[model samples]
Structures are given as structure tokens and as C-alpha cells.
Target: MEFHSNSTVFHCDVVGSDAHTTVLLQEAVDALAVKPGGTYVDGTFGRGGHSRLILERLEKTGRLIALDRDPAALAVAQAIDDRRFSVSHNSFSKIQEVLGQFHVDRVDGILLDLGVSSPQLEDASRGFSFRLDGLLDMRMDMSQGQTAAEWLASASEAHLEEVLRNYGEERFAKQIARAIVAARARQPMVTTHQLATLVATIVHARGRENKQNPATRTFQAIRIYLNQELENLSLALPQCVQMLNPGGRLVVISFHSLEDRIVKRFMRQLASSDGMPRKLPLRANEVRLLSRQTLRLVGKAIRPGANEVESNPRARSAVMRVAERINRT
Candidate 1:
């Protein structure tokens, strides 16, 4: 997939229907408090489900800048012929830079739907799923970076264990890592089924039974580590906060616990008053003047409704958190 300066076109063949039932569709956009004449950003343009909704709420003068690391996603984003919308082939972490390129200092709202998209997961060649047998490449951006197969082949057992434990929260990480190291010595682990089978074999022996596939956590760990998903989120959060104008909304929909934890903590830290000694001999007004609050939490985290989850199982794990930029005097 090649990215041009003005527009990015994806060369890879896209499999399956490009249609994605975006989780919390109306809820997420509503949280944005979008202003028809103001500029906004969609950090993850997965199939443009949310982008289209945002555009509908915007006027002719309103602008929407969409960003995505996946070439396939960029292809879908390019289909939007609206003059008010522009797509960028970059990660959400580069939100600030992308805004600068558009001469946008701050935006009225920013929406980020993090993690892998349906199209990427459904396409076997993209290697995002273990259920479908394909290459062991789980990269969000296949244009660059080492594939999951290459990482597994070269990573030490300790490193593998660390990733599985920290990123995937897998309990049998040590055993799985040991097994991977031993198996790779006999032959290279280069396919999704190969890796999945290896993990299932080890996990099953431990007598663990659940609805989810045994290889789920391992696949997630490898994908997260290889794609630097968590790191990108950490970097993008501060940038999103800084790029929002006063009263601007920041809506984030995270899929897993790890992602949700980071979002929750970041928002809490910013929403809390600056840590100051309570014993200080200062009046209430003086304390209010001294306290620094960057954000006002909108409400509690939101989860998909039972009907939505039944229709789209992927939405089951999603959690949306909303906040607004606090205007400082």
C-alpha cells in the first residue's frame, strides 16, 4: 500500500464485505457534541462508519480529518468524495502532526475507535485472525514492520513470556513461550494455524475450558506487541488532549481491559485537581484558582447493549469513555 502526499491508495485486494457495524455508532458520535461548522478528527477510520455519521452532523463549512494506519482502511476512507473530509495514512499517535499539516491548531472533537477493524480481521491474507488459517502476520500496517511470524521466530522465550503475560494476560505464558521456543527449533512458525495449534495444545493440557478459543490470548499478545498498539495509544492520548479546543469532546472506544485501563487512568489524572497540600492556609477561591484541571469527565464508561452485542459479537468487549476539554481561565 503506497501513500501519496495528497491521497493514499491501497493496492492490496480487499476480501469480504467492506461493511462494518460500528459499535456504539450513535452513542459515540453523540458524545462528540459535534459542531456543524467546526473541525473534527476521526483517529481510526475503520470502514468510515463513524466518519460518515460525523460528516452528516456537519455543515458545508465543517471539516473532518480521518487517520488510519491500515492500508485497507485508507482505501475505504478514500471512497468518501466529500470535500469537507480528508484522509491521512498515519497512526493516531501522529494526530498532532497531521493536524499541523492541515493548519489546524485545535479541533472541536476527536473520536478514536482503537484496535483492529472487521475488514482487517476478516481478510485471511492480512493475518489478523487465528480462526482462519493464513500467514502469521498481524500487523495493522502491512506496508512496514516485522510480521508476527518473524517476531516469534526471533524472540527469546523470556521475551515471548513477557509479551504474553503483560499484553495478553495469559496465565500459561511461561509454558507457551517454552513450547514455542522448542517447536521453532524443529521448524519455523510461519502460519496462523501453526501458532494457534501450538498454543491450544499447551493450554488444553492445563484443563482450561471456555467459549473463547485457547489461542485467543496468545494471538492478541503477539498482535499487540508486534503492532505497538498500547504504545501508540499512550502517545496519542496526550496529543488528543492537547489538540482539543476548550469544551471539545474526546471520545474513545476501547476493546479490551488493557486499553480501557489506560484511558480510565489518563482521564482520571487530568480530571483531578492538581495535587496540593490541603493544609495550606488558602481560601476556597485561592485553591480553585491554583488548581489545574485539564478535562471534565463526561460520564461513566459505556458498554454495548445486549441487542447490539448479539448482532455483533465483537462489540461485546467494547467500552467507550467520554470527556470534554476544560477551559482554563
Candidate 2:
């Protein structure tokens, strides 16, 4: 169904004090070079931290479309009364279809604040954090798919091992997977603390260098696997490129190396022009650029400054990368 900017509504966060500070806020927004009357997208609205700012920068006619799979995130978006802003409750991977529904053929820029948001992690009911003792339900979109607990119940040992290694990049993935299988056999792994304790028992990393909890990687791996985060990101990149208007920018903030690598490779591959068909030599003016070479790499991968990281620990691992669409005249 088509949702117009004026017709769409969002719920704003009332108690924003505890909200996770949006990392690299100015840098990511500036990368867009947002024009007053241009259209933009916040691919991961997360509590509308970036979306609210984007709306502020836009002119009265300028439009901003924000998307989030989490109902809680979308609820946070419902409080904005501006006619220029619209929020959609769906995965960013469905960019093409969502844009189509809005009658938006292309946008001037797109921002993706990827990974778990603070509210999702802090809210015990959502089951996104290892620090909380909630059910193992890590579905980004609670309305659909298998919960982390459900997946753990039936997933094969090999599959679980692969997810931990591939998504979390945990060195002790094999031992952790074995531990999970063994523990589940004794009793259905239900609460966050139960799983965390079990994983900690198997993973014996010693010393003061363990800055993060032992079960952090295991929970992350399960969340990513259950929600298909990497797969969704891979699917969304090409669509993001395609959705950009000529000269439009794509800004992405990835919290982990795995997600960052995928964005980097996707942008690099699209920016290169190595696969064009060979033809009779022609003048530079006569030669045409490959359609996929529509993007040009922006500045180097950006990281949060020490001050920002100190204020918001969540910013510590965030990495932002940007690219711009080259006019294909």
C-alpha cells in the first residue's frame, strides 16, 4: 500500500535521557550533503535519533523516509508531527518495494545506522542484550520468524557453529556450540542469564583483557543468525545504490567488523569499472561508464572520536563509510 508523507505518522521517544547516543551524528549527516528540498532515507531509524536530525535539516518540501523492523523503534517514530517525515515499519532490505509504495523513484541520500539500538538492548523484554535476564527472543521484528530460543532448540550443531564463527567471528565457536547443544539437552535454554552462564562456562578466556562479557559473542551470533542481519545487509546494499539519485550519497554506520566488511566490499565493487565489454577504442568522451560504476568512494572509513566514545560507550565500535552516485550522463 502506498503511504504518503503527510499520511504517515511516527511516535517520538518521551524519555530520551537514557537513549543510546547516536554515534558520529554530525559526520554521518554531513556526508549526505542534504539539500533543503531533496529527499532522503534513514534506513535504520532506531529510535529516530538520526531521523529527527534529518527532518530538521530538510526544507518544508524536503522528505525523509525512515524504516525500522522493530515495532518499538517505529513507535518511537510516531511522535513526529511534521508533514515532511514518514516512518515505515519494515526491513531496510525492502527498500525497492517500500520506495515504490511511496511513489519515490529515487532519493538524494540514505543513512543506515546498523546493528542493535540502545532501547532494544536495554529493554529486557526484547532479549537483545547479554546483560539482561530475559527470554532468548532476539527477533528484530517480533511479529515474524523464529525467536533465538526457538532456533537454538532445533538448529543443528554444525549450523550453530557456523553462525557463531561467521557472524560473531568468535574464536571459540566450536566449543560454544557444543556447550549449547549439551546444555539444551539437559534443559531447554530459556532465559538470557542461563545461556550466558552456560557459554561463560565453556569459554574460559582469562585475564583483565576481557573487556566484554563471555556470552556477548554468542548472543550476537544468535541474534544475527535469527534475524538474518548479514544477509539482509548484503541484499540491501545493491538496492541502496539503485535507489540513489544521480549524485546521491549512501552513508552507512556499521557497529561490527563483519558488517563493515560487507559494506566496504559492496561499495568498492560498485565503484570499480573492470567488467565493461571490450569494444573498438574510442575517445574518452565516446566511452560510456558501466552502470554499476555509478558510485564513487567517499572519505576513509570514519570512527567516533574519543570524547564521543567516552560519553556513549556504544559509539566505541561504530564505523561509518560513505559513497556518492556519479552522474551517469
The lDDT leader among the candidates is: 1
Q: Give the worst 10-residue stretch by lDDT in candidate 1.
A: 1-10
Q: Please provide, for model 1 over 1-329, each residue's C-alpha lDDT reduced to its tens digit, 9 standing for 90 to 100.
A: 22223333433332332888899999999999989899999999889899999999999999999898887887777677677887778889989988887778999999999888888888898888998999999999888999999999999999999999999999999999999999999999999999999999999999999999999999999999998999999999999999999999999999999999999999988888655557779878767755667888998999999999999999999999999998744
- Give candidate 2 regions above 4 Å deviation: 1-18, 205-209, 274-292
Measured by TM-score, how close is model 2 to the native structure?
Answer: 0.90
lDDT of 1: 0.89
Clashing pairs in 1: none
lDDT of 2: 0.84
Question: Per-candidate TM vs. native?
Answer: 0.92, 0.90
Cα misplacement distance, residue 105 of candidate 2 (Å): 0.7
